[model samples]
Target: MAPRQKTAGLLDAVGPAFSRLRRSVLLDVENPVPAKDLTRTLVLNIVEDGADGEVTVGVVAERLAVDPSVASRMVTDCIGAGYLVRAASQRDGRRTVLRLSPEGAATLERFRQHQRVAFEYITRDWPEQERLEFARLLLKYVDAIDALRAPA
Candidate 1:
């Protein structure tokens, strides 16, 4: 096949590949933590990233590429689930920021563990070097995307 076609095929597959991964139960196996949807995972992750700076609902919206109201509802859901807490920002007491509750941090860690397990299981048959390279490249790809979306 031509190089352009090969690249197009790869790009075309990415969406469905991500969609399937999102819907997969592999990440939820063993039930390490209380059941929460992907949205909560995303919100928790965003809050964790905020360890370097104050994170608000608006920040969540921007990070999630969602509307402010939508992010508000999602953040509220996270708070209700006890995974996040609303607190006064240290930089500006009048502004509210988000923090991960103790349970939230543990839950996120558990999720990461399960994700690693799932990835290992899925690629169990691949050559070890290939698996390691894929893991490194995938992390690099995701980190690059995150950096692009990061707040200015």
Candidate 2:
């Protein structure tokens, strides 16, 4: 096959692989927030960034590759659901910041636990070295994609 065709085939296969992975590891279980993947991801991002202070909706939108308006609506929904709080940025009082609520933190922790269990189960038969290499490669792939998306 030509190189382009081979690349296309690989990209096509990735979608189903990701869908299966998400169903198996990310979404099949019950969650306290009862949110869709995007919303859940938004909350998780907020929680992850909370320690550094507050994260902005614009930053979340950029990271998630969604429109700022969409990110803002998701943030609003999370705040309404008691998963996130909006506060003034300490560094820049004029800027709005997002912080995950306690409930959101707990929910994120549960999601992480589910991910860990799913990975453990899925990799049970794999050699530890292979598992580690798989993880390293997956992260490298993701980082490469992120780098491509970064502003030059």
Candidate 3:
């Protein structure tokens, strides 16, 4: 097969693989706190990125590649569910910043553990070095995609 065809096949496979993974591990998990898919995703992002400081809704939208209105609604729902908290940004009092609640952090950890176990099971037969290389390559691919989408 030509290189373009090989790339197309990989891209085709990625969509369904991601959907299956999300449904099996992330979206369908039973958690102590009930949350929609977007809410759960937002919590996880906040846990990973909000530790340094508060994360803004705009930032979440940008990271998720979603519309600002969509992100705003998800953030509001998360706050109502007690999974996230919004506070004034220290740097700019008028600006709002988001951080996960303790409950949100705990829930995110549980989800991470589930994902880790699932990945381990799926890659159990792969050699350790191959697994590490796969991870590195996946990160590189994602970064390349991000760079392509970024404004020049």
Candidate 4:
């Protein structure tokens, strides 16, 4: 097979792999993580890692590529779940910003640990160098996507 055809085949496999990964997480009932939902993780990550001065619902909406109303509802859910809190903005007391609560931080850490465990378990048979290289490439792929999605 030609190189281009091989690449096309690889890309074709990626879609199903991604779908399966998504479903695997949803089907993960054995883990007792409360913040198992992807939206919760995303909202918590945005508040924890993407905070710049003030992270508002608008910011979440923009970052999540979601509608303002949808972002509002999601943020509200996060707040209700005690993963996030609405606080007064530093720049303007009247304005509001999102902050990760202590529980949010702990939950994020636990979820991340859970992911690490899952990765290790799945790749336990792989050689060390191969596992490390795959991890590096996966992170690079996501970083490239983030860069491409960022506004110029």
Q: If the candidates were sorted by their lDDT against the true structure, best first, what order would they fall in?
A: 1, 4, 2, 3
Q: Give candidate 3 misplaced runs (Cα > 4 Å).
A: 1-39, 51-54, 143-152
Model 4 is weakest, by summed lDDT over 10 consecutive residues, at: 26-35
How far residue 95's Cα lies from its native spot in candidate 4, in Å, is: 2.0
For candidate 3, the lDDT comes to 0.73
Per-residue C-alpha lDDT of model 1 across residues 92-122, encoded as one tens digit per residue:
9999999999988987887788788878788
lDDT of 1: 0.85
The lDDT leader among the candidates is 1
Which lDDT tens digits does candidate 3 get at residues 7-76? 9999899989978765565444444234464456554565456535868888778778899998788788
TM-score of model 1 relative to the true fold?
A: 0.85
Q: Which stretches of candidate 2 lie over 4 Å from their true place?
A: 1-12, 23-25, 29-38, 50-54, 146-152
**C-alpha lDDT of residue 138 in model 4:** 96
The per-prediction tally of clashing pairs is: 0, 0, 0, 0
Give me the runs in candidate 1 sitting further than 4 Å from their true place: 25-35, 150-152
- Tens digits of per-residue lDDT for model 4 on 1-152? 99999999999999899989866763354464554455698888888866565899998998889999999999999899898988899889999999988998988898788788778877889999999999999999999988897779
Backbone clashes in model 1? 0
TM-score of model number 4: 0.85
Residue 133, model 3: lDDT of: 93
Q: Which candidate do you rate higher for TM-score, 1 or 2? A: 1
